[model samples]
Target: MKHNVILVVLDGLNYQVARHALGHLQAYCDAGRAALYRLDCELPSLSRPLYECILTGVPPIASGVVHNDVVRLSNQRSIFHYARAAGLTTAAAAYHWVSELYNRAPFEAVRDRHTDDADLPIQYGHFYYADHYPDSHLLADAEHLRLRHKPNFLLVHPMNIDDAGHKHGLDSPQYRNSARRADIILADYLQAWLEAGYQVLVTADHGMNTDRSHNGLLPEEREVPLFVLGSAFSLDAAVRPRQTELCGTVCELLGVEHDKPVCRELLK
Candidate 1:
């Protein structure tokens, strides 16, 4: 049987937080393939561009999604577009507009609420808060869709940990606690999908630095995590170390041929 794919993106998450959120992410590492690599550059590691790189298997330059407001030339055409065109039911539950902005084409159903108003307290250079509506609404929506619609391509974006880390710094107890909260939420969501016999892919757009800044392409802002779990892919030693290679890697894992350009360095 063709397996359904769900991609969970934990924004601004770092390796240390993943370790702390071990209970939620460990199974993916234990039962599937996992890896860690330092990102290619420094700060201003914006989320939209980084996620576009992940979804399109190309760099920001090629993807044309460098910032939150920058629109791609192929606006309604992307990896998700390709996925849905091939008959996969695609949907997204994100906490920010960037996900919708970057992967708008593939998602038949997209739901996200903007949290960028200056009136709100800024956490980690972005407008993410621990007890924000985006977090609860997104997770609830994802759970509902997973249970009801059962989309072939489901993507989730959780912003709590990153928000906490940015507001209180990476090593603060709030960051650690937020990580745990994210873990619980993720574990519950994964368990629901697992019980339903669906394949799951967990990763992040980029890692956060101790300094709580990502304006450039520093190693911390570039390095991210990739964990694939489910009956389709096995946990083996075939994992390779590649930063900025997530887009191509995801395409390969999904058995989808990306007609568009991919980062050659990642494939190498």
Candidate 2:
């Protein structure tokens, strides 16, 4: 069987935010097809390091990304690398770090220029950044690629939640609204992808805290959601998987070797 996966990362989504604002997201928890867990990403919990950890299945310390100071990915293993080895097409539209790390991601990557960047032209990908790009342009771009390239592993990451949380702590209405908007966005894309025969994973790099900014010892900053909604996973068997176990899961789905002890087949 030709297995496919679509990973959607909602940055800086605290568990409380999801629980309170994302009523739509609760469907995944009730659906037997989904496995939901509250998993701690990594220390620092910054976007750069956490996302690196997520893609590489290694902590920031091991991945050589202790802070947001770095731009490119070094010689390391990532989901994209595994996908390529298995002859699967891959693509992503996310933050600049992603594009910078993989040189347009080795397949196709949009740096997701946000309007928040003050209209600075993206030097890498041709896609221009806009403030409303996440809810509008990003989704359109992802759908276009899905229909055109049919990549086996596609990642769509939206950062509005993070921005909102940073600007107006998680308790603020903006943060709550961002969470709801994120849920709607994910629901729309997930439904479309599932209808077109794709497994979907909704997870986050980090969470927000009482403080307007993230990155601290607080659990809110470290713990994030990890929800897998798919057809291959047995509804009868559910597992609380660690963040590092994702590499093995992807490798298993792609029919490749992933012998890391932290990696395991989480499905039944």
Q: Which digits, one per residue and each the tens of the lDDT, describe model 2 over residues 1-268?
A: 5578878788888866776677666776676657667777777788878877777777878878788777654456777777766656777766656665554433233324321131111121223233345755666667766786677877777788888888889779998898898888766677778878787777888899878888887888878887777777654334557777666676666565555434344554
Residue-by-residue lDDT tens digits, candidate 1, 1-268: 4556777777777765665465757755654433332334222367767666666555667556767566433343455656655655555666445434543322232222322222211100111223354566567777766665566666777777677767777677877777677777776677768667666766677667678656565555666666666665544445453434554444554556656543333222
Tell me how candidate 1 scores on lDDT.
0.57
- Which residues of candidate 2, in runs, are more than 4 Å off? 104-132, 235-238, 259-265
> How much is the lDDT of residue 94 in candidate 2?
69
Model 1: how far is 118 from its true place, Å? 34
Taking all chains together, the TM-score of candidate 2 against the true structure is 0.85
lDDT of 1 at 195: 66
Candidate 2, overall lDDT? 0.69
| Pairs that clash in candidate 2 | 113-129, 115-130, 115-131
